[model samples]
Structure formats: structure tokens, C-alpha cells
Target: MTTAPHAETFHSDGTPDASGRRVGVLLSHGFTGSPASIVPWGRYLAEQGYAVAVPRLPGHGTTWQDMTTTRYDDYYAEIEREFDALRARTDVVVVGGLSMGGCLVLQLAERRADQVAGVVLVNPAVNSTNKQLLLLPVMKHLVKAFPGIGSDIKKEGVVESAYDKTPLKPLASMVAAWKQVRAGLGEVTAPVLLFRSAEDHVVDPSSARIILDGIASADVTERVLAESYHVATLDNDAPQIFAESAEFVARVTSQVAAS
Candidate 1:
């Protein structure tokens, strides 16, 4: 695995939200996305008097060249380390992620149940095959050779760049990560707040259904972002994401009091 140089940094315009024993929230962006995707959500939560961190994964925010050298363990390890940091800063840490980042958070909640107070997943890619959609692992290999999807497939509430070039190797890595997380789904017992886009074409919608059906968390609540697509964090549904997530954090924080 290629080890990239680590430059640690934290900059938030809002004051600490964990004052007076409040909860902290950690936001993670999807694969191929930098903290930029979760910046809006982090800022919104921070402004509401909550400490938030949107960590930059190793090799990310640098270049596709750097990402090409990293492995799935490298990605998952960085998130686990960051989640620990967030936990140290506050009494309760509510974790959330977008897309593959969502899968990372779910994996964390399963194993570190005591540390994570709650979860919010936006357009999570839990299972590769959702919506009766067949994403042949073989297709990724094929796309590696011929990486053009022809035209930009337009969806509501967002504009997709349409990664015409599929790096089959990267596809294989992400799938591996998903498989590990999927196996650990039963372990993530924290109450989860799930969001799905009715129009998302990237990740399978069935991914959400599997979580809803099996997770031990009794307080799971799901909302459909009817107005948006896969990248709901950037689309019109962003406001709804902010509002609902803020509420979910508050709900979990109250649990601390009850206990």
C-alpha cells in the first residue's frame, strides 16, 4: 500500500458544540468525495452548537493518482482513527456518512457501539445489488478497459460528473470494503437514521432496505429524498438532510440523559 504524507488540520467557523456536556458529530464523505461534500452538513451542525469533524481520508483530496495507490484497509483505518479522536473530544459522538462513507460509519457503529451514540446515513451503498440492479463485479473489470458511459446521465437535485472512466481496480477495492461492512451489519446496534433518494442511480436502493430489515437498533427511522439523486448532500434535499440529522443528533443526546 502506498503511504501518503499526513498533514493533520482542523478548521471550523463555529464554536464548540460540546460545551455544557453536549454531543459531538462526525461527518464522513463518500468514496471519490472529499470533505467538501460534507462541509455544508458539518457547518450546519457546528453552527447549532455541536462539534463536528469531516475528516479527509488518506490519499483523498490530493489526486486520483494518490487514490490509485491506497487500499481498502488504509481507508477504513483512517476513519476508525478519526472516530476515536472525535470520541475523546466529547462525551457522545454521533457518526454520519455519505455513500461509501456511510458504509464506513455503519461498520464503526457495529464494533464501537459504546463510543458512537447514533448514526445518519445518506444514500448509503450497503449492498452492490439494489433495485434489482445487477452491478456485475465483472463490469468493473470491463469498464477498466473501456471507461466511457457515453453521456452524462441527468438526475434531479444534482448534476453528476458521470465518471466516464471506471477504474476497475478502485471498483474492486470499494466492493471489498462493502462486503466487510455488510457482514458486520448485525453488530451495528445503534439507532440509525437512513436517507435514500428515490432517483439515485449510483448505489442500490435495496441497500437501505437490508439495514432496515436486520439491524438491531429499534429507533431506526428512514426518509426518502424524493427531490434529489445519489449525491443528496449537494442537491436540493440538502436542507432536509441538515434538519433531520440535527434532530437525530438531538434525539440520541437525550438518550444519554435517560440512561
Candidate 2:
């Protein structure tokens, strides 16, 4: 009667059923994205004997309308719920995300404390006032007036969704959420492993340095994805991301075990 964890198509990205494994990594995807985006990474982890949960937020993986129907709090709340589930099923957690998802994971670390063993951020969104996104409200209203590039996310090797059309209201809500998350960096206590692409066209690269300085974690390490772009998850350097992230998780899990 029991099913394998992650067996469901819609992964909650929270905790897993505690049948055997004790370690878990919860993955949160970026804004305007879905569990499908992060599923590859989670599947890789799952093969390594780790329970991986990739949570799809309210609006994601559905339609632009769904995204508009969601709020920033709604998005963060899903992450919170999933992280708590992971906490219940595992002894330690290494929480991570890409872009906006990365910001949410950090918020979880700050808010949840040691319950989160470590943090991993891949091109995380830190600040909210960047020029391209300053006119988000307008973009939402007139997305068709100017259907922007889907994803210029150039990694050395991977190609992600390059959708031309965009829904505006969702982005506005995300911008508001990003502002809230940026204001909350001080609360993160878990150690961090940050990966930033040198040529990320979407998020500002400089923000990583600011995060490295601002977070409260006692230890922080960074990796530069020189061959990647904004959506590293689907970039050519994705393998590197998978490999490096795996090592990071192993290292942190070991640290907690020793202590």
C-alpha cells in the first residue's frame, strides 16, 4: 500500500516519507518555473540514495493565469511547508534553489535556523530594483506588446525554455517577494554554498558578493559558473552544478554527522 517517495508526479518539494532514508535535500525552482525545471537535479540526488523533493509553487507549471493568481507569500509559504516536511522526515537538510527559488531557500535557512543543515544558491535573486525588472508592472500589462526573449540563459551546454510570451502580474508579485526576501537575509544561519554564473543575463552577478557578506552563516563558499547563464539548471554546465552541488551536500551532511 505504500509508495516510493517522489513517486507522485507533482512533487511537494517538502519532506519525504520516513521509511529508510534520513537525509534530504529540498529544491525550489525559480519564478515562472516549475518542478520540471528542478526535477533533473532532484532525480540525480535520488539516485545517490538521497530523498529529493522539488516543490512546484501555486502558479508554476500551469499557466500564466495561475501565476497571476498567486502571491509572493503564497510562494514562500509553499517552500516553508515543504521544508518543514523534510525536517520531519530527515535528521538534516541541505536546502537549495535557483534564482528566486534560491532566495526562498535562504529565507528558510534564516527563519528555520539549524534545522536546515546548509544552504545552496545557484544564481539566486538578491536585490529587487534592477533596471530590466523596474517596469514589471508594465511588462505584465503589455507582455504581448513586447514579447521578450524567452530565456537567453546561455550555459556552456544546456538550453532551457525560451518562451516568447509572458504574463505580467506574476512578475510584479515576484518583484514584491524578492524585496521581502532581500530584507530578510540577516536571519539565515546555515552555512552557504553559492554558485553564480559570470554571464547571467537575468540576475545581477554583483548581488552574490553582497549576499556572501550579508548572511549570518559562519561559513560560506562560492563557485563561479563561468560557462553558464541565468538558468544554470538547464545550462550546459548543469552537470558541473549537479556534481558540485552533490559534493557540497555530502560535505555538509558529513559535518553534521561528526558534530
lDDT winner among the candidates? 2
Return model 1's CA RMSD, one decimal: 4.4
Compared with the true structure, what per-residue lDDT tens digits does model 2 show for residues 3-28?
Answer: 22322223333333333337889998
Scored against the true structure, residue 90 in model 1 reaches a CA lDDT of 72
User: What does candidate 1's lDDT look like per residue over 79-189, in tens digits?
Assistant: 898878777777788899988788888888988987788999998877865422245466654554234221122344343333334345565677766767777788878
Model 2, position 249, has a per-residue lDDT of: 83
- Tell me the deviation in Å of residue 253 in model 2: 1.7
Scanning candidate 1 in windows of ten residues, the lowest lDDT window is 145-154
After superposition of all CA atoms, the RMSD between model 2 and the true structure is: 4.9
Clashes per candidate, residues 3 or more apart or on different chains: 4, 9
Clash pairs for candidate 1:
17-49, 17-50, 110-188, 147-164
